[model samples]
Target: MILYHTEPDSPVIEISVEGKITDHDLREAIERMRGDLELNGKTRVLERIEHFTGIEPKALWTDITLGVSVARKVTRAAVVADAVWIRASMHLARFFTKAEVKAFHVNELEQARVWINT
Candidate 1:
């Protein structure tokens, strides 16, 4: 399950994932994010991965197709997770995405927000 929300009047999207992301959830998130990006021209994403089992193939494909331009518009990313693999992936994302990505442990969520907002 995915829980998505935004900080009002701010170009920040907060997302928490448990289990897997459904296509409906992905679409709704993309819509809101796209609207924000269109208005602000850039965005910051805060992803909290608690227990991300995985996303389905269709959801992955949808994300890929819809996220290309959206990804570029995200200028900052704050990832809150304790997983080594997620941190490693964030490191790799620096090379591929325009966003300045930072990873933090679950306890450091506040720090991540500060870093992303600054």
Candidate 2:
């Protein structure tokens, strides 16, 4: 499931993801994110992943497409998770996009939020 904590007035897109994700979930999330990007021009993101088991390949494709479309518009992104693979993936993302992507341990969720907001 994808739980969004987005504030309409804020430029930050805050979301929490758990369990397996479907294309519907991903598409909905990305659509909201796109709206934010359109409104703000530049955006920041805070994603907290917990017990995330998997995601459909189609959802991955959708995420990739939509993410690439908004990549240049994202100024910063904070990913909060304890998974090593997720953090490693965030590190890899730095090379592909201009955004300053940071990964924090789950315990540092507040720190991540502060960094992203600043």
Candidate 3:
């Protein structure tokens, strides 16, 4: 399951994912993120995903779609994940998107927030 919250006023979009991530959850997160981008226009975004246990292959595809979705709307995107693979993939894939992508551990969430906000 995924739990998401957006602070449009603060111009920050935050998303939290827990348990195993399925395709449906990924789609929902993507849709919500898109809405935030459309609402705020080129805002900074923060995604916290340390609680996420695993992901389905379809969810992996959905993640790429979501990245593209965000890139089209946001100027910067920061993701916090303890998962090594996710961190690696995001760093490598950032070059393909318009949004500058950065991944951090959960402990670095605050720093990431500050970096993106700044």
Best by lDDT: 2
* TM per candidate: 0.90, 0.91, 0.79
Which stretches of model 3 miss by more than 4 angstroms?
64-67
The residue-by-residue lDDT of candidate 2 on 83-109, one tens digit each, is 888987886876557899999989999
Off by over 4 Å in 1: none
Q: What is the per-residue lDDT of model 1 for residues 1-118, given as tens digits with 9 covering 90 to 100?
A: 8788876688888988878888888888888889988877778999998877888888888888896667778989999986778867887775547888888988999998888788
State in Å the error of residue 46, model 3.
Answer: 0.9
Model 1 clash pairs are none
Ranking by TM-score: 2, 1, 3
Score candidate 1 by lDDT. Answer: 0.83
- The model with the greater lDDT, 1 or 2, is 2
Two-way lDDT contest, 1 vs 3, winner: 1
Could you tell me the lDDT of residue 68 within candidate 1? 67
lDDT of 3 by residue, 1-118 (tens): 8887765376777778778989998788788777776777767767788666789999888777665656666777788888878787886655656778888888897899898888
Model 1 residue 30 CA deviation in Å: 0.9
Model 3 clash pairs are: none
In candidate 1, where is summed lDDT lowest over 10 consecutive residues? 87-96
Per-model CA lDDT versus the true structure: 0.83, 0.86, 0.77
lDDT of 2: 0.86
